[model samples]
Target: MTDLLPLWRDLLLGGFILLAYTTEAMTGFGSIVIALSLGALILPIDDVQTVLVPLNICMTGFLSWRHRNHIDWRLLGRLIMPFMLAGTVLGYWVQPVLGGALLKVGFALLVLWFVLRELRRAARGHVAAPKSGWWSRGIVLGAGVTHGLFASGGPLLVYGLAGLSLDKARFRATLILVWFSLNSLLTLLYLNQGRLQPLAPHVLAYLPLIPLGIVLGERLHHRVDEVTFRLWIYRVLAVSASALLLASLLQLG
Candidate 1:
């Protein structure tokens, strides 16, 4: 029974990885967020993040390379990356000071509001005003902080990006590049802190699922129209935020 227990855990972990990464591959974000949310049911959240963060680089790197031409470098370099990176540094420094439950609950409420508003607009056939000025940048900054704290900042990032009206291809490709850059920085930090050494074996064990997830996601990505693709993004944000809210509330209780 003891031996079988380990096998069952491994299988569950693999299943979670497959499902999470497939979502990311299709949408260009959400793998870590979804994986952490679901995997926490079976594994420690810290362990789940340690394993997923490094592994995400592999998935994002491949998609970035394969769709390099589709990336909107001007938007990424000028707006998203710089603001997000700054926020990440700030978030990392303050993580110990700010409690996890507070941050998670706050973030969940913010995401839920944004996603619900967007979904309602879509349902009414109203076009969303393009995000501009400091508002969009602020959202990107918040996403960076979330990424730094949890390595699952996709919801906020997606919310910010949706304003740009990117096509599905550019949307997926550009977001993948953003994640690749951010995750690389995170991996370096982990290495400096010697946090990844103990987790290396688990990372290797789950590495195979990356390619498989990407393949499945690619096939599904093509079937969805642009409108449906946008809708799916909002739906993912709603689901992720709701889960985060529930988890945080549970912890508080």
Candidate 2:
């Protein structure tokens, strides 16, 4: 594991953290997916995951607390949490055998699929629109597995949440709370496996920047209209997906 403190690396990683969490703070999700895709371009994938997961846990925890009163507990409890937990445990167990290059390709494909789906919906004048009665056990479990394996499960879970038709505030609040719980479980699995300890020093060093990102993200969240927000989010998803795909191809070549 490379030490995270070589000043330039710290600054670069710090910028990604700020950008990722700012998205999270605004949209109630996206931190992990955005961060991992961009950070992996500079740092090793495992190293990026090492520090980012813990930082995400902290960031989502704070967001969850801030929106505690608005959480859609029924949806979270009955539909999302259970399968996500099961998938996380299972994915963690399977992670060691999964090839990094293959995983990146799969992640990029999945993200692009989501982006196209959202764009199609937007073209139909349905931005931020939720589909009715699309919830299922499989989507939840798949989200957990992806989150467990790649730390980029937010897109899957976010799409699922969009279908449920909760108001924007409640939707964001519920997503944050769900992430806080799921990430906590994933973190515990990491600890039990002895993976988190090595990343602590870097996490500590980056702690100061977290609050700044959160504050800026919250402000951005308030300023943006729902339609415009969804547009920018899909655009970002497309860009990040493209970047990750390019990186994987370059590595293969």
Question: Per-residue lDDT tens digits of candidate 2, residues 90-187?
Answer: 77778888747777788789889989988998899874645444355777788888888877777777666665567667877888887788788777
Question: Native-vs-model 2 lDDT?
Answer: 0.79
Superposition TM-score, candidate 1 onto the true structure: 0.95
Best by lDDT: 1
lDDT of each: 0.86, 0.79
Counting clashing residue pairs in each candidate, in order, gives: 0, 0
Model 1, which residues run further than 4 Å from truth?
none
Instruction: For candidate 1, write residues 36-97 as lDDT tens digits.
Output: 77676667767788889999999999999999999999999988999999988887778778
RMSD from true fold, candidate 1 = 1.5
Sliding window of 10 residues with minimal summed lDDT for model 1: 37-46
The lowest-lDDT stretch of 10 consecutive residues in candidate 2 is 127-136
